[model samples]
Target chain A: MTGPISGPDELSKREQKALESLLFRLADDEFVLAERYTEWQIYAPTLESDLALANIAQDEFGHARLWYDLLGELGYTEPDLIWERPPEQWQHSTLVELSFPDGGWADTIVRGYLYDTAEQLRLEALADSSYLPLADRIEKVLLEERYHRQHAGNWLERLASGEGHDRVVAAVERLFPHAMSLFAPGPHEDNITEFGFRSESLQELRRAWLDTVIPTLDSLSVPAPEPAEVVRPDATGRDGSHTDDWFELYDAFTHTYTELENPTPVRLRGEGA
Target chain B: MIWEVFRQEKKGDYHKHCGNVHAPDREMALMFAEIQHARRMHANSLWVVPQAEIAEVDAEEASFGGTTDKAFRWAMTYNDIDASFAQEVADSEKEQEKAAKTREAQI
Candidate 1:
């Protein structure tokens, strides 16, 4: 009642598929990207960075859970929905699924920088979505992501000015191609836009991201990557094609959950048995 | 070091336990507490106490007769509060007033 009561009456056939695609993109992107970020949990250059990354990972996983819960309400079982998906069936952007190659602090910083900027645009648009549930979810997600954006911005400033400037610049150049691919078109993007689920097209969001990120990189004296001639992929993630990194991520994240044969007993906080 | 933060939601309200924050000093603790607890615009003000400065008591050590009886201290003890309860309270007040008067006279 506080905001607009502009949500759909009930999801139509096209609307349902659009919403499902949106949720899959958002949920899979965050879940998979958070898995990659967790690899830096103990290896970050600074303790504060480690804690910040861990917090970001937690928020991403939390966002994924909220999306998964929404999916469950739509009548999909959670485990089957998440674990049953093949790598090629995931809808996460290629940017999120890219590997950082263990290139040390610079790679992590650059990855966080690019992903946070892109995610901010995507999430801000989703925050205004006509879907009430998705809008509400974005409200909570944006709060945490604001911190992630700030963390990335702060590091971008520091690394771009400090002795590690060249290293960060190099990493940016290497990753920007895949980062731009986050906007690769999916089959349902036009329907999603037409339904008012998102206000902007993928190109528009990418432009907005560049507008926001380029100036900051400029201020930090970090050179931005040149825009590629051909940004589309014949077989890219937005169209459900993923790299081997997706399998790596799926394996890492689902390790513990897959190990149990039967339902595990819940353990109380201080209980030994 | 860890600092325990207590937040007052409005003016003149008692500070309630919000959460703990880790910081090296009072300044950092204040910064973290402001962001962690107060960023949502709910907190009016906050008090941060170093974790080490807090004194804690366990309820188990302070139990009275395993909770068998402490009815005299509770309002429910006077379940039948028609006339006798008022009379009893009046008598107690009178006794206290008399005792105070006697002490004053001695003084």
Candidate 2:
């Protein structure tokens, strides 16, 4: 029988690498997606929805900061880890990197619903992680994700019940495949699973996600994507292969950092600088 | 909907104002507040009040100012209590003692 899993300090070499990769994927995906969400800060259909999206974006950014801090403790400078990396070096899932088409409010809701469902699944699984620090962080993240899931579910219900329901359903159908690809096994997936960093495999977590989401989608009269079609993308994100949008996203996100004369600070500044 | 959340760090402690969260209703507000505030610490309990239900009284109102002097009600106004009140208390105690002795002798 397997022994009781220990905390971050007790992590094995393989486990540490796997955890680092997972953290990178989690943090980068949220950070980049938050920028996209922020684009709708003033453009949402309703003021309340706009505020909700912005709030969620801020929460995601905070989560990224937390993960980045973890990465720093594991021997990586935050700026070098986030800003200096090229687009191809990023490990964010393709679902988050996809450009939200100017397809109006329906498209936005569908995208939000898809991303939230996937995030909820990943976070729930991570909550049982062997690493104490990761498990604790995931628990905190899961709390916020509950609201995000509810908000997305509410919008999905509204769109499915109201006019243009068919259009929204079609949009979701088109996006579901990409959403499934969010769980594509990373380069260190085998090591992560074997080392007990996560209690479940990538495929196992994806299956669990589908079990919950497919039923909900069916209830909403939206068709779910087939499991076979939900495997790795033509450009696998786990292998550092990403779409063209990733380059644009990376450039835009790191523009300020790249333009700075001294991107990394060597000494302390004012009180909170 | 806006919820104002007050959180208590431990049992028997007073709940202090933490922050606000926007939700569709009270249930969602509580859920969001639990996540936003209490997730990081040892919060024992939370009190959530709807933003609309909160009543505010302006302390800056000019009409509510006190018009009369009520200085006599304040202890600070009766200065030199050791000199004035102490003698009065001693005299009163002596009178009470004399009355008690006369009553005892009559009995």
Candidate 3:
């Protein structure tokens, strides 16, 4: 049997572009979501919840780092890929970039549950990818994602039964539209699947995401939005288009790097326990 | 019978001594440990050992590390050399520094 696609050289020109686009999508979504998750650091309702979210954010950043390192293999430096890149060039779903409303713990739970369900499906599809490098990284990410989903799911169920049930419903109503953007395909969607980068189609993933999230949410009395009312056609975050919040978020995150004019971002290099 | 309990707070974390539990057998020991040692605190895994099975040596019985001034074994011995160039060395230095402080506290 032939070995998996280990390096850039093994891919055809189209396959390489497809792989690059896929990596950018994965890395950008994870990095942006993690950046937003950090905003809850000291603000979460409880100490244990705060630590849990922070740990999840760190896991997402680590996953993003793995994807970005692969991009490095394809010739982009870290700065070129992130710190120095224009805000408009990022390819993440707009759902991840939105800010959490103050005291809106419900917002965080709903958003996390929706986003993580989608992420789980996406990772599963990539688990058997023809691109060996991408496939190899999925298991590590998937292991951590298990906790994230359970965390979100548990919080969602508990919060739905409490005095904050109204807030949770409002969060569902407000965030469902943007959550759809997770399934919004980038231009290379077909190329990615055609080249064996992801074995499942985006539509299939979207369908699976719906099947998993909608019923549980419905059971919790959280209504999923009608498809027509929440159609966010402009949220093709996969194609580099994003909401105004993304650029603002991007600038804030890169502010330190730009201010210091540092030669490179500090990498703890797995040394920090 | 008393069971000595070791609790690990999270995956990849060290299994540290917490508290002990009293149970009749291994299964009961584990169940008791789960409630007494792990219920309130976050725990990834737990280990239990019978108090009878554990062996201990007190300071009066033996001098730990031979009470030697063997400063050569510590990374801080060569204070002039920079450990920054290598991560493993830096990590070792930090660990040794922590150990030194603990030993100082004990004394």
Per-residue CA lDDT of model 2 for A1-273, tens digit only, reads 134455556667777888888888888878877878888878886555677777888888888877877787787876677777767888877777777777567777777787787787777767777666777788777777777778777777778877858878778766676776678888788877676667777888778778887898788777777778655457656668888877887888778877894366442332235
Write candidate 1's Cα lDDT for A62-158 as tens digits: 8888887777767887566676555678888776776767656787778888888888899888877777888887877887888777767666666
| C-alpha RMSD (angstroms) for model 2 | 6.3
lDDT of 1 at A221: 82
Candidate 3 TM-score, C-alpha based: 0.73
Chain A only: TM-score of every candidate? 0.87, 0.89, 0.95
lDDT (tens digit, per residue) of candidate 3 on A1-273: 234687888988888888899999999999999999999989887655676677788888999999999999899988999999999899998888988888888998888998999999999999999899889989988988887787787778778878878999999887888888888777788888887889899889988988887798789887777666775756668878888888889989999999999557767874332
Q: List the residue pairs that clash in candidate 1.
A: none
- Give the number of the best model, judged by TM-score: 3
Off by over 4 Å in 3: A1-3, A270-273, B1-107
User: Is 1 or 3 the stronger prediction by lDDT?
Assistant: 3
Candidate 3 lDDT (Cα, whole model)? 0.85
* Model 3 interface root-mean-square deviation: 10.3
Q: All candidates: CA RMSD in angstroms?
A: 11.0, 6.3, 19.2
Per-candidate TM equals: 0.69, 0.70, 0.73
